[model samples]
Target chain A: MKVLVAVKRVIDYNVKIRVKADQSDVDLTNVKMAMNPFCEIAIEEAVRLKEKGIATEVVAVSIGPKAAQEQLRTALALGADCAIHIETDERAESLAVAKLLAKVVEEEQPGLVILGKQAIDTDNNQTGQMLAALTNLPQGTFASEVVVDGDKVNVTREIDGGLQTIALTLPAIVTADLRLNEPRYAKLPDIMKAKKKPLDVKTPADYGVEIASKVSLLKVESPAERKGGIKVASVDELIDKLKNEAKVL
Target chain B: MSILALADLHEGQLAGATARVVAAAQAIGGDIDVLVVGEGVHAAAEAAAKLDGVSKVRVADNAVYAHQLAEPMGALLVELADGYTHVLASASTTGKNVLPRLAALKDVSQLSDVIAVESADTFKRPIYAGNAIATVKSDEALKVITVRTTGFDAVSDGNSAPIEVVDTVVENNQSSFVKEELAKSDRPELGGAKMVISGGRGMGNGDNFKLLDGIADKLGAAIGASRAAVDAGFVPNDMQVGQTGKIVAPDLYIAVGISGAIQHLAGMKDSKVIVAINKDEEAPIFQVADYGLVGDLFEILPELESKL
Candidate 1:
């Protein structure tokens, strides 16, 4: 069985987000970029399956500008057999990215597809489910654990209150949660080997999908900053203030 | 505009977040109807019908929806999506699982974790873990949205809207429920609690989490943990409070030994009053806290519990 994994390039998680001067969008000028953390977990899960011999091949696909190839190369170095880049300049919304991945899924016909639950940039946890909808596949989202058994896959999902385990037939979609697996770093030798791996670049139009966004960003701004309060000399003072001044206790 | 709000439920009871979703829909100015989908959801449907501003309650009771699996739920929503202008649900796990599929099947875009309803077409949502707020406008005729319940007040329950039975039963063979392990606790849920006391890596281990229990019992507060604690195997993921975890905004939030990373702050910064107790005076948690107490949690927890 072959596994297809979707990765994304986003502003590094450690960088503080800054709104542009005109308030059009976030200021991403010269900020560090990296593969989304959750995507790395997704890639790790796929590679683990390949290592276990359950997956015959692992393919990594990404949708973004040319710079996204950096993330795809990172995915390759992390153990994906090959990579595909859906090169585009538009701000690919969840639905558009899902559509592009659906087209790739149709062509690749991988037995299983894995993706991050949400991209940290948009914080939109929609692409995996949308791709499943478009492709008529069952989705086990927010998966903390995934096991392939016979012709079925058992996905343990991280839900609101607890964990839920579900079984989906072959050729299904699974989205990785934070606890899925700790991603491994690529070695120097593997990074060099990744440079020689085959990378196919394609456009959304090539798959008869348009990467146009339906939602328009009207403005972007920073959240309200919380003011620091005075330090209490003792717990007695904190309790007194909570009960008297704030009246919340 | 006609709006349909999907009711959030737990064990066949309507979840509190459903009321907040209705509050968001009311902001959009519509004839709001609530949809309750689950097996044996008659009581939940009744609860939904009583929420203020609800015009009606639509119930789909079937075993297929017992687990609220995304496949059947999405199909049911698509079948009922013909006349509604907006479909809304709380940004709970169930909503996050199903709404996107409905949006895609309808060939429309979804606005996730909407914090503000600016207009019928415009919304404000937090991106980059609430570090940046983006105001977005959707051009789709049918808008699917997930509401971050903390951003809006839950509507009062008084009105008695009519309840209608939805006969649509979607057949799904792709996935089947295997089992579930839910944490059972008598304490108020973290999302709806009035007071929350969360610990961090400073808690040491799972056994040390017992320290918060005394204070929690005294104040009737819910117990939470920062992602650091959860990652350290000190607690379960459901107890995690952070950007990637449960977003909570209680009347009073107590951070015990928490260093307050930005991701953790995103979940509870909207809290009415925040109190931080940590040994390190320079911990970032003090910056956002309304009251800062510098001390060792091991000693502070017992003293605070006794004083309360």
Candidate 2:
């Protein structure tokens, strides 16, 4: 079976994001960039499927600025056989990205598609499901556990409720949840090998897909800083403060 | 201008988030029409009709909408949204699943999880897990948005509006619904609960969650856990309350032994009142908390339960 995984480049999870001075966008000048952590998990899952002999080929795809090619290369190093970089300087929203991915899906008819539940930067958990809807495929989103049988894939999803186990037919889309698997660090040898791997480039226009903006960002601002509260001495004082001052008890 | 809102219903009742989305729709200009699609969902449709600021309730009753799967729903919404300028839904699992599909199918960009409506075409949303807020303006012909229900008040109950039956069905038999293995919990649901009591890795064992039951019951709160507690196998993923987990804005949020990681704070910082109980005085939770109790939760929880 063929598996396609979508990866994204975003600010590293550890770096605290800062709003730009003008509050129009995030300040990205000095921030450390890395592949989205959940996307890394998706890459790890696809590599595992190939290692288990269940998948014949794994292709990693990224739609972002040219710098996002670094994320595709990282995916290749992590174990994706080939990579596709849809170069665009536009900061595409989830719907636009999903449209681009759906165009790719039509060109490359992979039986299974794996992607992160959402990107850390946008946090719009939409692409995988949108792709599934566009292609008329089943979607098992926020999957913590995925098991493949002959033609059926049983996915245990992490939803608002507890775990929900859904059995989908072949040719489905699954988004990786946090607890899905721990992604591995790319070894130096693999990184060197990834340089030699096949990397294909495309554009959103190549697929005749138009990214229409529905929401325009007015400003980006830091969240309201929480003020520090006075520390109480005794449990009784805490109770008194809660009742008299806070009135939240 | 009239805004069309989609009501996400499971079984036969309005999801709690639907009212919040209605409230968001009311914040923006115009008459609101709510659409309820599902088989045997008349009860839900009727319930949605009762929400304030709703001018009309459209019910699309069909067997294909049994699961109200994203594909069919997207197609239906596309057909129904031809005249409406704005389409809104709660940013719940259902809304997140369906609206993006509609946007992609319609070749329109979708704004996910808006926290505030600045105007008809502009909104504010949390980008980096509530670390930063982005105010956006849309120039698209049609605006597709999912409202972060926690950021808005739910429409008050009263005044049932007229219900309109929309006879629209789009057939795309691409997927089948398999049986679901839903994990049942005796406690209230995390997102819908009025109060929440969450524990972190400091809770120690899986069984230690029982100690929280007394206080939770006293406060009528749902039980939640931090990612650390969930990763430690002390609780299920559904119990997780954080950036990557469920975002809850309850009346009161009691964080027990939780050292307020930024991710954890993202989910519950919108709570009306926050109280932290931890041994570490330097824990980050104290910063956002309205009340702080520096003590071991294991002892304080029981004592607090007795006192309550």
Candidate 3:
């Protein structure tokens, strides 16, 4: 079985994102960019499958600006065979991204597709499931654990109440959750090797997919800051405030 | 314009989040219709009919929808996509799993986890873990949306809408229901609870969670954990409250030893009142907290338990 892992480049998780002064969008002028945390987990899962001899190959794919190739290279360093970059300047929404990936799925002919549950930049947990819908494949989302049997994949999903397990046929889509597996950092040698790996760059138009955003962004602004109130000096005072002042107790 | 709100039905009862979604749909200003899709979901349909602003309830009772599985549910929504100007659902795991599929099937974008309905075509949602709010307008004629129910107040029961059985259940043989291991708790659910008490890495171990049990039981508060605590294997993942975890809003939220990472604050900052108890006085949690107490959790928690 072959696995295709979709990765994305987003603002590093540790960075505090700032909205531009004009409120057009987040300030990305000199911000640090890294592979999306969940996508790294997905790549790690696929590579682990390959290491275990359950998968024959793992291909990394990304859809973003030209700079997104950095994320693809990172994926390659993490043990993906090669990289595919769908170059686009437009911030394509989940619908368009899924369509492009669906076309790529047809070209790749992989038995399993793995993607992050959501991207940190847009916070849209849609693309993987959307790809599954477009290709009429079963999706196991928010997967914390995945095991491949003879022709079926057993996935443990992290849901609201607890975990839910589902089994899908070989050709399925699985979205990685945080607890899936901690991604391994690429060694210096692997990073150097990834620099020389084969990378194919294509435009969305190459797949006959239009890169039009369906949602129009009107504005972006910082969330309202909560003003801190004076703290009580003692537990008695805290209880008094809770009982009399806030009346929440 | 007409809004079709998908009822979040688990088993046979209408989820409380469905009422909140209906309220969000009402805010969008439209004739609202509730779609209840499940097996033996007449009770859910009846409950949806009683929602304050619903005009009609459509029930598509089928075995394929028994577990809110995505495959058949997404196909059914796509088949019924016509004739509705807007399709809304609660931003639950089920809705998150299905709405995007429907949007893709229609070749349109989905506005997800919407915190406010700005206009018929515009919505305000949290991006980058609620640090920033983005106002977005969808050009798609048929808008597919999912609202974070915590952002909207649930509607009260006051209407008697007509229940119409919908026979437009699309069938798919892609996946089937598997076993679920839900946490059986006697306390109120975290999302619906009036009060919440959450711990973080400072709790040390799973055994230390007992320090909160006495207080939680006394106050009828739901127990939660910061992502660090969950990552430390001190609690189940479901108890996690953060950006990638469960978003919760209650009347009162107490943070015990929770330093409050940006992601964790995004989930609980919407609570009416927040109290942070951390030994680090400079912890960022205190910045947004209405009340802050600086002390060792082991001493403070025991003291709090004794006093309360």
Chain A TM-score per model, please list them: 0.99, 0.97, 0.98
lDDT of 1 by residue, A1-249 (tens): 999999999999899899999999999999999999999999999999999999999999999999999999999999999999999999999999999999999999999999999999999999999999999999999999999999999999999889999999889999999999999999999999999999999998899888887899999999999999989988789889999999987
Residue-level error in angstroms, candidate 1, position A222 = 0.4
| Candidate 1 C-alpha lDDT tens digits along B103-146 | 99999999999999999999999999999999999999999999
Kindly indicate the candidate among 2 and 3 with the higher DockQ.
Answer: 3
| TM-score top scorer | 1
DockQ of each: 0.91, 0.66, 0.81
State the lDDT of candidate 2 residue by residue for B1-308, as single tens digits: 77999997744578878888899998888989999998899999989988888899999999888776666788899899988989999887778878887776776778888999888888998988999998888887888899988889888879689999999887855545655555576667788888899999889888998999998988888999999999999988888898888899988898998999989999999888888888999999999988888888778888888887
lDDT of 2 by residue, A1-249 (tens): 999999999999989888888887999997899999999999999999999999999999999999999999999999999999998888787877888888888888998999999998988888897888778788888889989988989887775565666677889999999999999999999999999999999988998876656566778899888776676666677678767876776
lDDT of 3 by residue, B1-308 (tens): 99999998654788899999999999999799999998989988888999999999999998878887899899899888799999999888889998989998898889999999888999999999998999999989899999999989999998999999889867667676678998989998887789999999989999999999999999999999999999999999999999999999999999998998999998999998898898888899998888888888888887887888
> Candidate 3 on A139-209: residue-level lDDT in tens?
99999999888888888999888998988877999999999999999999999999999999999989999
**True-structure lDDT of candidate 1:** 0.96
Please report how far candidate 2 places residue B52 from its true position, in Å. 1.6
Per-residue lDDT for A34 in model 2?
96
Give the TM-scores of the predictions, in the order they appear. Answer: 0.99, 0.95, 0.98
Query: What RMSD does model 1 have?
Result: 0.7
